[model samples]
Target: MRTIKPVQMRSPVLTVRRVDTYHAITVVAPGVAERFRAGQFVAVAVGGDTSSMLARRAFFIHDVKPDYGGTVEFVFEVRGRGTSWLSECRSRDLLDVTGPLGRPFPLPRDPVNCVLVGDGHGASPLFPLAHTLRRRGCRVDFVLGAAGAQRVFGALAARRVGETATFATRDGSLGLRGRVTDALPQVIEDARADVVYGVGPLPVLRTVTAIAAKYGVPAQVAVEERMACGIGLCMTCVLPVVGDDGVTRMLRSCVDGPVFRGEQVRFDDVGTIPFDALGAPGWKARPDDSASTEIGQ
Candidate 1:
């Protein structure tokens, strides 16, 4: 859980720029910047005050700058009306933002060999995480992937930040011609990684977890879930996760995670609650015709 409480404020836009295939927005959010941890996210209210769009768009905190009091930057690809509106935002625009939300990536207590994997804009958070790891004496390596070269975020930065940077593109437009996961196993092996960290869509995370398991290394993954609210109040982002007690519970991604032990997540059961999950219907009893009839009566 986060020790710093998130604050909602009308933050002033500091910069808006196009970064290859993504848009990067920096806002003057001192509160968020000061308390931010890599892998945490922010939710921005779009469509101004009167527009009908109700849900706040969630974005990972890409980076933070200490200048001008403090500022937080986030990157995104404009996929719909809400994001399109965000792209048009200019300097000095006041956007309602709430963040440094979600549980952040937990840092290791001792320096170790680490491999970080990212996909598309999901690579945003890993850059900052790599920096932190290096400062803690961890050797950082990167495996970044996207559909094409232009879509792969932070390749040049990865080269500079990591001990070695490996890239994969499905179209053969970059490093290796395959999914990022295709490059993951080799990177982990060569780096002699003690731990693997990943950020991407659910399927990618699932594959990353499997690869780490094969190498007998622990995996920490940040998941991409459609969050209706960036707070725990909304149950929209719940996913099945096995706790230390071996109980499968539907945990909220916003608060309980966006970052979780990769092995503990029931990735295949993400969209549906597992029948045996705690509190799930029929977890204790098998539903049958007699039970249904009794309930009806």
Candidate 2:
């Protein structure tokens, strides 16, 4: 896997289209598009130049087109003020964007059977990834889920991109009347998937990881976190992850990864640093504080 240095630029909004229950914003960003990799994302400066929102909102690139040099598309739901302001932007409006950040999904060296799982707007990144996987002679199957039909992001595109696309909605407004995980085990068995990839809420990734492990299939997952800087400088998005040496360390999601091996991530310890993690406070006292001595003690 390769990571390219990102560029910060003010790109004009090409279009803002509403798809399903999400908003898809396309920006004219040649630099970002030129370096764009599947599973990578862009950080957008919302609320305009004079606005008070200092934290940049990160969104995964849904598509990149070669129109007007290059254009990048990202999807989001208007949950708060940042996204609410973004939803109001129109064609010809300019947006400050920096991308294609974070470690992208690593492709296999040889063609393999791959199952891609996504929930809600998290399905955006998987579209580009699915296309790339197919080009490498891999069999791609999709398991997309959401709360309801309007919440499912890309049913039509998933159908066109993968060999088979299965959908589940809680409200039974889509294919199967359940969540993606409920339908995943059967899909894995039927497809004989060699590897699994997922992008969604933390809970979803955690469940997907467990299911993939049960089937003895390798999994790579992209995590969604509230990135304050989107550039690793803030240190606000650290999570405990096991290194190859078997030591758990706090790693930054913005730089270390938005993508990681499913089994290595400490999913249950995401929001808080684990006490046993390397360099964590009181790390030396975990097993036996009675025997452990401090510098002055």
- Candidate 1 residues 131-197, lDDT tens each? 9999999999999999999999999999999999999999999999999999999999899999999
Clashing pairs in 2: none
The sequence of per-residue lDDT tens digits that candidate 2 reaches over residues 1-297 is 444899999999999999978999999999999999998899999999899999999999999999999999999999999999999999999999999999899898899999999999999999999999999999999999999999998999999989999999999999999998888998899999999999999899999999999999988999998899999999998878887656677788888889989899988888888888777888763453343211110
Superposed Cα deviation of residue 175, candidate 1 (Å): 0.5
- Give the C-alpha lDDT of model 2: 0.91
* lDDT for each candidate structure: 0.92, 0.91
